[model samples]
Target: MDELVVRTEVYADPETVYEFLLDFRGYAHYSEYLREVRTVSGDGGPGTRYALTFAWWKLTYTAHSEVTGVEPPERIDWEITKDIDAGGCWRVTPSEEADGDADDGSRCEVSLEVEFDPGSASPDALDLPRLVSFDWVLKKAIPLIRGEAERVVERAVRDLEESTRDVDLEVYVDSDRI
Candidate 1:
């Protein structure tokens, strides 16, 4: 089993960040490698299932996943059910300095653990010899995951900003009409 942990500060509120993380279908809008996402069962609540595909190394791998835990505006955890044995979590913590007096920002952390069976497929499946010789794959994968998480955080912030802007414009228009 290989584990990767990434932590970063996002310039968005905790609630907003948490909500974005739980929006499984929106992952492709943020994750650079995720090519597609679809809800398979349930309603994105705990135990909801989803299918995700990632485009990397000129190959697309699909994984079935289920939400393992969810706590609004705080934490969410998920486990992969097919293709690979993996799990991940997203955590949001309030950032006093970035938020100023409004509590508008948070520090986000994402962690992932994945284990692949080198013997499951052909000898060339994962280039096992290369992995043993140079540790190339895991090294590359960790940084990729970190960058993806960062991008997701940025996307969440942008989404929140756009939503707020839209709401403010609506309020202004309504006030003028009244």
Candidate 2:
């Protein structure tokens, strides 16, 4: 299993960022790969479970997630219980330059952790690259998977900035690293 981490800064307090992530439904508008997410049980805190669906062109995959941990204004983490071995998290804190509810200075970092072997039983990983599809990815899917995943996350950050109007969310994408 390989792990990839990509982070972006948002001009919102830790709590605000936390809230945004807590509402999984709002993420549908963020990435094309994400179809929609709905709560299956409990509040969004730890132990909460969600029914999530994602797609790449003609291929679609569904999975259930149980939030494993939550630390308000700091971090939140969850584990995927089906289809794939994956996890996600967000880390928020006061930006060094910003204080109070000014919105301009406060920032939070978002990260997603994925651990899946291409040789795994599921075809979800190979089908993630809409253009590359299963055959090419199955042959050597690492680069293709990583690139597509990064693009998905990048789009999410861009969408998050556009939706977050109360603050100037400056999201930085690292093209050099995915």
Candidate 3:
């Protein structure tokens, strides 16, 4: 399995960031390929199911997922149920400045972490268009998927900062491979 982690520090508190991350629907706007995130069942909490549609060029796939875990004001976890074997988590925590003191809830670090094995999922179940093989699509998409993870977090940070305050905030994206 390959893991990707994207992080950024926000001028908002942990609760604020947590609430923003809790709403999975907003994620569709963060990535260009992500067309929609529709709720299938339950609320935003654990047990909620979602259909996340991603489209690029002539390819479109709707991946099913379920909210597997949630910790208020801190974290949310989900597992993909169809077309792929993947899981991800959103983490929000108070940021500690250089002086080793927490920012008194004024600033926090927000992170999105995902784990997936490109080869683990079977292509037989995929609904591919005529003359388009799943292997061909995977070869072309694997690289884009990695970059998409980074792009999503970068956009999410910018949107969150813009929504929190009127003034523009500096955006810094820290990406890690694990």
Candidate 1 lDDT by residue in tens digits, 1-178: 4444445455556776777678889888878899999899988789899889877764456768899888877788898776455676766677665446645344443322233332232323343433353245444454465456555655655575564221110011111111
Worst 10 residues of 2 by lDDT: 168-177
Q: After superposition, how far is residue 78 of candidate 3 from its true place, in Å?
A: 0.4
Give the runs in model 2 whose Cα sits over 4 Å from its true position. Answer: 97-105, 123-178
Ranking by lDDT: 3, 2, 1
Count backbone clashes in candidate 1.
0
Question: Least accurate stretch of 10 residues (summed lDDT) in model 1?
Answer: 168-177
- What residue pairs clash in candidate 3, if any at all? none
Estimate the overall C-alpha local distance difference test score of candidate 3.
0.79
Candidate 2 Cα deviation (angstroms), residue 59: 2.1
Give the Å error, residue 133, model 1: 14
- Candidate with maximal lDDT: 3
For model 1, the superposed segments whose C-alpha errors exceed 4 Å read 97-143, 161-178
TM-score of each: 0.63, 0.68, 0.87
Clashing pairs in 2: none
Per-residue lDDT tens digits for candidate 3, residues 1-178, read 7777767777777888888888899998889899999999988999999999889878778889999999989899999987678898988878897999766788887878888877777787567889998888877777676668777777777787776333322333332322
What candidate 3 gets wrong by more than 4 Å, as runs, is 163-178
